[model samples]
Target: MSGKLYLKDKLVDEELDLSMMQLTEIPVKEIEQLGSKVLKLNLSHNLLTCVPANLPLLTQLTSIDLSKNQIVELPENFGQLTKLKSLDLYSNQISKLPVSFAQLKSLKFLDLKENPLVPELAKAAGPCITANDCAKGFF
Candidate 1:
């Protein structure tokens, strides 16, 4: 079944929560339906192997939770989420950030716990033990 949860509050017009859906992929079309109204997206606790390549189109997103998945890497154009502030990637197989990641100037919080990053990158990343710690890895 395609599980979906929609939320809204005074601050946000819309949010899409698809946690624990056992999904291998994100329903881009369905998500696109909400357009710029969507701000937060939750895809944690699934079996996703990769993030959607077209994720950069959702420029309105501010927060995204992609934790507890099998994802190995993020979309090449992930840096296009210039408005994004918070990102959770806990317990994934990600090793390194893409070159374009440096473009995420608006990012304020990041979580990269449990990822198997290479020693060189890990040293640069430091202890990704918490969201605060992960934020230190980047500018």
Candidate 2:
């Protein structure tokens, strides 16, 4: 079955929560239907292997949660989410990030703990530090 989408604490049209679904992929078209109204998305605790490259099309998004999934790599143009702020990718399988990751200038929070990251990249990432410093010098 397709994953279910819901609004924030209250059922609204501005955010989407698709967490705890057994989804292997995100429903891009379904999410696109929200248009510019969608500003946050939660896709945690699923079976996703990869994030769709078209995800950046939802430019209005400022937060996203992809933790506890099976994602191994992000889209090459992942940096297109220029307006993004908080991102959670903890407990996933991500090893390497795209060079474009440096483009997330607005990002303020990121969670990459528990992933078997590459030594070089992991060392570059340094000790887990929350807040806006999470993606510092990530290029």
Candidate 3:
């Protein structure tokens, strides 16, 4: 899947906007080439089903958008993204999160609405839309 890569509006390496690329897979090599310079990466609105587990190598990522896609299961080590403060996984085919999801200690905002999640897992995850009401269930 060939997709365009763009610097986030000021020619800075801190943010990369790769959204709406119609990509079938994560551009791991390109992203890794960017190294720790990127703090945010947007992969939303694409055709990705599973992301490369090595994605966590970009340790500088503070936020990532994987919303509005066809992803069914995230990489098992996805929670290794400890620096991620915000994660948007809305409107996907995810039913249960990986057990390692507990490793996301720094995650502050998570959107899990509109997923056909398993009842138990969904209940445990709550809405996770806000820190006040859905804080305890984020895992």
Q: Best candidate per TM-score, number?
A: 1
What's model 2's lDDT at 133?
Answer: 63
| Residue-by-residue lDDT tens digits, candidate 2, 13-122 | 66678888687898878778757777888899999999999988787789999999999999998899999988899999999999998989988777888899999977
TM-score per prediction, in order, is 0.85, 0.84, 0.83
lDDT to native, each model: 0.81, 0.82, 0.78
Model 3 per-residue lDDT tens digits across residues 1-139: 1346543342265767778878888887777776677787888899989878888777778988888888888888887888999888888888888877788889977877888899997877676556565556454
Off by over 4 Å in 2: 1-13, 129-139
Q: Order the numbered candidates by TM-score, best leading.
A: 1, 2, 3
Error of 1 at 108 (Å): 0.8
| Residue 130 accuracy (lDDT) in model 1 | 62
Which of candidates 2 and 3 reaches a greater lDDT?
Answer: 2
Ranking by lDDT: 2, 1, 3
- Model 1, 17-53: lDDT tens per residue? 7788678998777777767777988889999999988
